[model samples]
Target: MHEWALVEGVIATAARFAEENGITEVTEVVVVVGELQQVEHEVLEFAFENLKTPLFKNARFVLESQPARFKCRNCGNEWGFTSEGMTEDVSEAIHFVPEMAHVYIKCSECGSPDFEVAEGRGVWLATIKGVKGDE
Candidate 1:
């Protein structure tokens, strides 16, 4: 699953951060996931469990979801996105490439496809807690 790839990237980034910061032992990592990615939490958790490096051996992986929000350029109307009414194919398309939102979604107020993804686009390494070497 793509979750595995995502977790690998997260671990690599976190490990790099820990090394750069002289963190000897990582204890926690907070990851923020955007809703538009449509990532499966269970799969992500499993991937994290299987793919973590020695630096993250004891790290508690915390996941948070960020809701998708859009702002209309046409009318300056802002709104949240929900997949409730989308077909599986449409949802899958957006899941793989969130930029497709512009193709499939319209502004709630102005009914214009021209809009901006105000938030909730990709994964982020929100925070990392660890013991510094000199601590």
Candidate 2:
């Protein structure tokens, strides 16, 4: 599943960061998930449990959700994104390709398709905690 791929990238990035920073034992990793991505937390957590390497054997993987926010270019209106009224297919499409939001979403104020995703678009490795080599 895509969650596996995403976890793989996260583990790799965290490992590289630990190596570069001389962190001998990773303690915790905080991953930020954008609402637009619609990542399944259970699947992601399972992937992390299965995909992490020795460097992260003791690492605690934490996932946080970032609410999607948008800004209307036409009316200058800003609002949050919600899938409440969206069809399953449309929601799934946006989940796989966030940019597709432009095709399916519009400004709640002006009904204009021209809007910007002001926040919550992609995955991010927000924080990493570990024991340095010297420690």
Q: In terms of TM-score, which candidate is strongest? A: 2
Per-residue alpha-carbon lDDT of candidate 1 for residues 32-126, written as tens digits (9 for 90 to 100)? 98888989989888999999888888999998999989999999999998998999989989887888899999999979999988899878899
TM-score for predicted model 2 compared with the true structure: 0.92
Candidate 2 segments exceeding 4 Å error: none
Question: Residue 110 deviation, candidate 1, in Å?
Answer: 2.7
Error of 2 at 54 (Å): 0.9
Query: Tens-digit lDDT track for model 2 on 10-42?
Result: 999999999999998999999998899988999
**lDDT, each prediction:** 0.90, 0.91
Clashes of each: 0, 0
Q: What's the distance in Å from true for residue 33, model 2?
A: 1.6
